[model samples]
Target: MTMFRTLYGMLALCTLLLAPRTLPAQAAESLRTAEGTQRALPRAPRLPRTAFLENRTLVAAQLSPAGDAVAYLREKKDSRGLWLLPAGGGNARMLVGSTQADQLMWSRDGRWLFLRASRVLSIVGVDGRTGVRVPLGGTERRRVMKLDTSQPAAVLLGERVRAGTGERWRIVRMDARGQRTLLREDAHWIHDVALDAQGRIVALARFEGDHDALYRVRPDGTLREVLRLRPMDRLDLLGMQADGSLLMAGNPGGNFRRVMRLDANDRLQTLHQDPRGEADLDEVVIDPRTQQPLAASYRSTVAATYGIGDAQAVVADIARKLPDRDIGLQAGSGPYARWLVSERAPTLRDPRWYLYDPRNGNLRRILDDPGITANAPKEATLAPKIAIDYTASDGMRVHGFLLLPPGVDPARAPLVAQVHGGPINHFRAGYDGIAQFLANRGYVVFQSNFRGSTGHGRSYTFASNGDYGNGRVQQDIVEGVRWLLAQGIGDADRVGIVGHSFGGYSTLLGLTFQPELFKVGVAGAPPADLGWSMRWLVEAGDQGDLPDRSLRHTLQALSLDATDRATYTRLHAQSPLVNAGKLQRPLVIIAGGADRTVAIREVIHYTATLKALGRPLTLLVEPGGAHSPVDPIPREAYIFAMETMLQRHLGSPAPEPPGQRLRAYLRENLRLAGPEFAEFSSHQRRNPLLTDNSDAQE
Candidate 1:
């Protein structure tokens, strides 16, 4: 009997030992089931349209020179004002109410806030009691070039005025007593000016026709040319270092712009350069007291900063803790350093700001955009952008960003080739509203940095300078799409193209010249006839307050050759309006009624020609919209129209229409003037862009 009892006890102990191991497996199975059920359930409702369109409530937050107070611009409804808050904890107070003041800078003594209001330089007391405007002498726009807070009483100003058939640039030093001293004047445009700690002009950038001349100011107040950039090259002077050496950014020998220091002896030393040749050194962080470079930021696939010293090393460590966000040094140094870190991702509707202090080793949330945080969908997933590269037809390497919808098979997804404006500009990895919105709705978004795009070296830029509508520039985009299709990342049957300004021109070209590649096109502020647009720019030069010489120069650099009639004829041939009959796909053209950059008349004429030809096109006009729509109502409406059109053409599941409030706002703000306005109604026929392709396989 004792042996049997002992055996029973041994068996029970073995069972107990095995129970924990089996229990975890069972729990894991149960958890998996729960997650599957959750996935089957409907997702959280999407945020309202207005939630994405509202302007930022807080912006341009800066710390006081003493680091005892913080000042920021606050916008509520239609009112924008400056507000101050004590760092030690106190009630925030409005310094100035109902003012359009911006570009806030603190005085050296921390007693005044210097700002620009209505194109005039002004200053107000920190207590919000006294206000004074620096008499700039004329209404001709004046820009604050450099403010020497160390001196506390003087500022460098760039004054623009009309010269004989061109614009003349002048640099002046203005004191607190309203006394102005002219420093230099030139017929060529002055791009920027830099001042030393002693309130002396140390460096200046002058645009002289084909190249930018960078000049150094000597101790005798004489200007000497230090460097001259080629026609397509870019150069920017940051500031004078503690040793009086000039810190500059440009690509002198390499393909990328790197931070370099130029000494008085004309010797150039490289301070920082990114390993990726595509990155451009953007901004240099300087120590206010020592006037030295602490860190510098460069933008490649995304913005990244590198520390030049131990003090900045701590800041870089803190930045690494917060992945996928851009960190900026707003003000202060050492233990009292304050940083403005932005959380910008495609999944986020708006950016969130944070303030960090190295002394306390604490990162505190300062501002959360109410529009995004309060209204974002609970189940929305953030999409990831992948950096990609492809070879063009001529074997030129091209780079681009690709965003695919989460939880969807990219092979079966419809693709939108979203081109950026500024055929001169290139797209960076960040929170692009349009790309995110489209990806959220199940469309893959691809942004290509074609040959003409910046950040790829001067040769690449010059390659696209004269090749606007046709040539290798357009072929680069075509090859990109074909490469994606060949990789099975895009559904060839359902593809669309969309762009703004110069991008709009590319969209028109794609639809007219390569109709088989796209099923739909959406263009905003596109210049249809290059020749007419150039002429209009010259004619409208006299109507505006600014000079037109820059516009003429731009025309000469891009699509014009004043000496060749054949070149003009080739440019005219590239106009989509001349080949409206080839537009077999559905197209939507958006125009800003008040757009001065690309006149509304050009859009009107192009759409009128398409309408006359009975092509499948829709035109939506924003009555008082500028080149870029800023008003939330009209902007949201424009997005909604694009969404609806894409859904119909791609055969994707349509989300809920714009809420009643949004629809009412759109009706009040946007004008539906196209012949097919009825097609945009609640009950309308499927457009020609929506073709039934049941034979397409995944």
Candidate 2:
């Protein structure tokens, strides 16, 4: 009997030992099957996230003017350096491996490469024979652009700083002998400086009051304005003609950009224009081999996708000459000769090298990154477009991009009017997932290029100059939503609003001041009170109190300020946190703990106000994130939290991830006792047994 009992115990122990290992395998198998089933479920089609994910890392690509060799800045987390690769396509080798090394450039001859590391600039021989620092001879503040060995001279441009009422900039020249010469000086910045074929120092560009103008400089420090701009005209000096005329691009008379030539006689000749005129003058180049206009590339705003039509036509005409050639736009090159003029092709890393044969318009597509072509997403689940116009508070015609759901009929889509952050920024038409992601689950996304937004004229861009966190900016967003439902594309009943940074402040103001519009609200890194933000602005380099900081002084002069401190306090009371009790919809707030710009403490105070109001809200704090949660991990966390909250309020489909238990735990337990939950709860409260019944009942 004793032996039999001992055998039974041993068998029980063996079963215990085997069960744990086998259970995981069973669970993993079940998980695989469940995931497969979930994926196979009949659902709206979406492209693999690989399309956006692959290009997430942006390296500074430097290319030779001839497009034969390339160098780029590569960063793997904290580690960063320059990597060199053949322009025609080959293995990339690390030229400089130190983290601080960046700003790689090729000399005019393309025989050598230069990189800036801290205070020192290192030069590399293309043949891998010599590497040394070229001694800088100009003032400490002056910087040089290294040219080719054939030219053997570098152009030095100085920093422009406004002193008192005058602007001061120093332009200098340097040679291989490490000798410096003060070539020219200007109060305004010299925008474009290039060595002509005759080795003449030409100052073809200058920045004046938010406008660029073409200028010429004699070898002596004398400046001559070659072409003056109209109040609305912006000059982008393309390059020099072989005969010494300047090639410039800008919309001189219309809304769209057009290429034009400023001849020796100062005649502006129009080159080409698309009907939609919203074409972006990407870059311009003349063919050194042929001494003719090589090619010009432009990106169309999503609102006016008609620009792509011209691009397609131009490429089709080119393709007729070279049969079976797919073309892409080369991103970066020099003044003469573009790399690619092919239509619908992905832009090369350095877009400037794009060369189109002006004689025949034949595109040269070299250095094809097949990985991009092979993995490029072809799915049509891009951001939707709704061209709507709204009368701003000032009665200006404000055009905005209203993105609706991918598959939903326009009539059934919910609204999520997302205000872009840069009050100075504009949202162009493009394939953006954030808009599509909101839309995919069923929500109409509205992105506006409000009054402060650019791509409009300078007058429109600086309209909201001193009006940060004021009513004018907030009204633009409010009026945008009213225009949407007015168009009957959005369901006014189910509307949510969201924004980030400055946009985040607008989102909060949209809810607090105009509570009836948005049914649900989210503000990422928003500044709550204007007074605190004003103080923050002062502390964070607003320079309003300082005398020498003229830009800040100029900006301060442009803003709408209270006549007195008392009036400013009245403005503060109108803030989102001042009236948190008015929030009718669920609110979600996200803040980065390490945020330096928009203080995380401001968000915390805002959330605290909402919490005090007894309103349901979710607060997410990214640990190592900053005011800009540009990092992938934290951004994903913020996006997930936001989507989950928005889905909860607006009834949109949730993304597949974050298992049910985890989601539930976040919703139930991490509601507000974030990070400090364990410390905050007592023994009885911490015990799941005690709380389980009460939580279930509640």
Candidate 3:
């Protein structure tokens, strides 16, 4: 028997409390209508709602040229921090000493470590020496930019604004001594900067509009435009080559991007073509481990770079020497070393890393962080991922993951539609909390990479064009539910939906627009109204509160006349609030009090409407939660509320106390058992934050 069978009593109570009330009214009106309204039997593979979130962590330690040490990041408890270990091997030391610090960069000399925190830039020495803040002059304006440091003693590209005037950025000399000297200032904004071996700078400058021109500038102020991207042609720089050439990764004349080498004489050569049907290269890092380009990391970090040269064959040949693990390309430092062919080992779940050493066709586990299974719970296991495709309403193929629960009847699991954020960002095949938590409680979670999701081609992404907050995206989600039902994997009568941010918006729309498909919904930090969000963004200025400029431009391009209120009203009609009256399902609306992205006012208004309607709506507000729940108390409280809600609605087990259950789940599933588990459990016992804020939001 599965875990859920033991909790049927809890499921019965939820069904009795939240059942649709109009059933009796319709039953008396007409026999035919009543028959049509009868709930369908639960689908097979009704996965449990409990799953584990596999946090994305950085591994595969590599030392710099000087080999003082190699560093990697360990992501646990949702806290990401850097740790340094001797390159040859020894005890690991914490680098930043705090999870808050990110973006670690090692200078060529390996003597200095640079980091960008918010808008400020600082460097730390490797010797654990005291840190010093580089002098950034001026009290009003921020630095325009920073120099590309591949070259030695790189200059600082910065702009200092006058008290009451606009500023022009000038290139300034910056050395290890922290000295500065003005170089030049111009009207154009520098899009990219790369330093050549000789200390000359190659800059990608954009004039008015989309016109980008590449220029080589010497310290003496001599400048020359080596290549120009015409208004008609699309050309962009990836980085600078050691031989003074430019590495370009954009489509000048093709569907997919191919690595192009542009010489000083303006001639172009194709180095490598991107894999078919995959996202184009965003950036490439030369592998310092092998002196060859090892990996190409994409925006989503789902994809990686591979060597097309002899190394490809060599990696395959070397794979024979290693365990039967999945070998793939990984991204990081220098040339010839471009693709760090790696083997992902699942027995460790931590995925033991193996470096692709082409010279001897050998693969070796680089650095291993063995999964500590001692503390993990026995009941909670890592969710199983299966890749599948479903056809959308428009006949477009949609790809997604079906996260199944462990040891379940596959025939009668409840379903939770887990929508991912970005609406544009696709779901990667990894462990996540929101989905796994639902699975742990006996709900089959369907994570879709619907239309408008990235990692696919630009065309597929554009399908979401003008569809922002439109019915199209919602239909994709709705169709996903239908697809699961078609597969006989989820019970339609027990389906629920939940998401955060855009995912939250999808959740709202999913409930409001297709109420019959799901019995309950949870939307966290969702934008209730798109129009209000746009206005809020415009008012936010440069605080990153608004959508990307490209998105704003696309919205206008779709003929959304901003001058006309009717246009705004028509678009606003697509919001969940406008159709809230159509919703008959229960919903949990959660929000952070200080969310700068989506104002709390909008959520308050939506919940106010639901309250006025006397609907079965539960609202969870976090006093300290921003767009994402970070504070441990609020986050745990959120998990508890969600678990209890699912238990109440889907008829799963009565939720264990938030603190006890969460501690157990974390320990059992995350392998955080024994003393560490006791420590974490005691810590939670001591902190009343989660329960303390439960009534605060209400």
Candidate 4:
């Protein structure tokens, strides 16, 4: 998974799905949810509730340019501190107190760390005594193009400058010695940049609305268009190869992205395309020193970057040594050099950093970030996530994960198929908070990367062809659940579905279309009608969350065309709101009143219609909650309400009675409690903060 999706789960989903699996009950102040649950399934859970919600170590390790010392960041006293770990295993010392560091890179001579916090870039001395702030020039934002660590101690930057009548990007070079030089400028918005070994700009990718183009910078100061992609296609320039050709990964005229080399003559040469032709060129790790790619892999957690040139052999060796492990490349001084690597071993369950010495072909475990490792449940208490794939009804292969309930038999335990947010994003075999929490709750958890999910390739992501409502996308999820059931992985009569955003919509679709298959559902911020949602996305203009026209292009590329009458009708006919009366199974929808993604008005309308039709539906409308409801009270309510809903319908663990804070908030926000929320509504209303008081408002 990408960092953006990881952050979305943390901030937006809050601690709702990320309910920590605690140790005993040191901090189990449950929403009457993850923390304070007091019930047993076949038996009490081995790992407490808070274990899954534990925070990760907010630290990163970087191999210094000399490759003899490792510079790492650690969270200390609410601020970040820079520390140096000796490569030869000696005492690590704090170099300085760095507050709120967003991005950082070591200068060539290892004398300073150029750290960027927001718009200000400061070069802090490694000696802990000197600090120099690099002044910036631009309209409002000055983004770092590349941390040019080659020579002359300079950094490449892109400044959005005001042109004659519009805005353009002015690429400039800023040195540690307090000097700046204008390299070149571009008319379109620059998204990707690459530099040659000598620190000269080789090629860059720019975007104008949905159209993207990659240009090669000539020595005479002119840009020659090398490759251009249509709105429906994708393209990315990785780096400059040692032979001066630009290494790129894109789906120029095809559905799947492949690794290629664009020479000085603009001729394209295929490097590696998935030999099986089933997966995309997922992620590329570039060498900072040479700006050339080290490796590429299809899975988000790549076992290794084993598809480049010289760096391929080194990574392939590492892969051979650590087979079945997610060996992701972290940092290295130059190409074919010592690397700071991150390995996600099954035993660890979480990624651990290591210093890999290519000379000796050995990996030495280094100091970890320690946030999750220090607080996670013991290995015996937790079960490993098993990666599995099965063929769908259409004969196309589908991949997913299964996290069986600790100590619960697959044939006897309840099943909860948890869906991911982006219909395009896929689940990797690693730490998944929602699946872990649900499995800990004594339910067999299933997460499937349906047909439209990414990672497989461009064709895989767009395969559903805007059929999210009831087509292959929906069938993929249902087929996965059925496949697991046939394997005796879950109790047939006690299966439920849950998710957020698009996953939320999938949950709704599962209950409406597969009522007998899914006994209950819990949806968060679900857009009741996919057709309306797509139209609203394109017609409402840009929300400024992403680049201009990025969202529109994504919708268009996915085949969701609001202008097409037939396409809109098909999406509308399959939508849950259009067929709400078919949903006889129990469902509890937790919605954010302030959610712009799924308008609160539509949710209210759907709930009101369900109430009129006497459907078993409950709605919790959080007035202050945004799309993800990061707030503590609202997030707690989501898990608590869903837990209660499932417990009532699927015979899962019964939630503990509500606390004062939760009761007050629920009493006010439970717009329609049907049968699922009747237990929570019966909680005593004698709390002091039951009114429009501080606790209730929170």
Q: Write the per-residue lDDT of candidate 4 for residues 1-698, one digit (tens) a residue.
A: 52111100111111111122222232122211221121222443445334555343445667777677887767765678777888877978988675556567877777777777665777767677556675453354577766665554667777877777877777788887657888777777777777777677778788867677788888876888877877646667677777778778887767677777787777887777766465676667766666666677665323234647787667887777766666677546664457877765333445677788878888888775364257755545554555555667666767666666545667788999999887768887666656666766788888887878877776677677777778788888888788667655689999999999898899989999999899999999887888777676566623322442367666667777654677678888898988988989888888887777766666666666676678887788888677887655676677778778888888865776777898899988887777666765674343221122332100
Q: By descending TM-score, how would the candidates be arranged?
A: 1, 4, 3, 2
Worst 10 residues of 4 by lDDT: 7-16
Q: State the displacement of the C-alpha of residue 58, model 3, in Å, after optimal TM-score superposition.
A: 7.0
List CA RMSD, all candidates: 12.6, 16.2, 11.1, 9.2
Alpha-carbon local distance difference test for all models: 0.66, 0.54, 0.55, 0.69
The stretch of ten residues in a row with the least summed lDDT in candidate 2 is: 1-10
TM-score of each prediction: 0.84, 0.67, 0.74, 0.81
Candidate 1 deviation (Cα RMSD): 12.6
Instruction: Please say which candidate is ahead in lDDT: 2 or 4.
Output: 4
- Give lDDT: candidate 2, residue 423: 56
How well is each residue in 302-381 modelled by candidate 3, as lDDT tens digits?
Answer: 33334455345544464455433334454334433323344432112344455544444445455555432222223225
lDDT winner: 4
| Model 3, CA-based lDDT | 0.55
**lDDT (tens digit, per residue) of candidate 2 on 292-400:** 4545544333211111222444444554553322233332333333344333311111222234543455554433455323443443444324334456545565656
Candidate 2: C-alpha RMSD after superposition: 16.2
Decide which is better by lDDT, 1 or 4: 4
Which candidate order results from sorting by lDDT in descending order?
4, 1, 3, 2
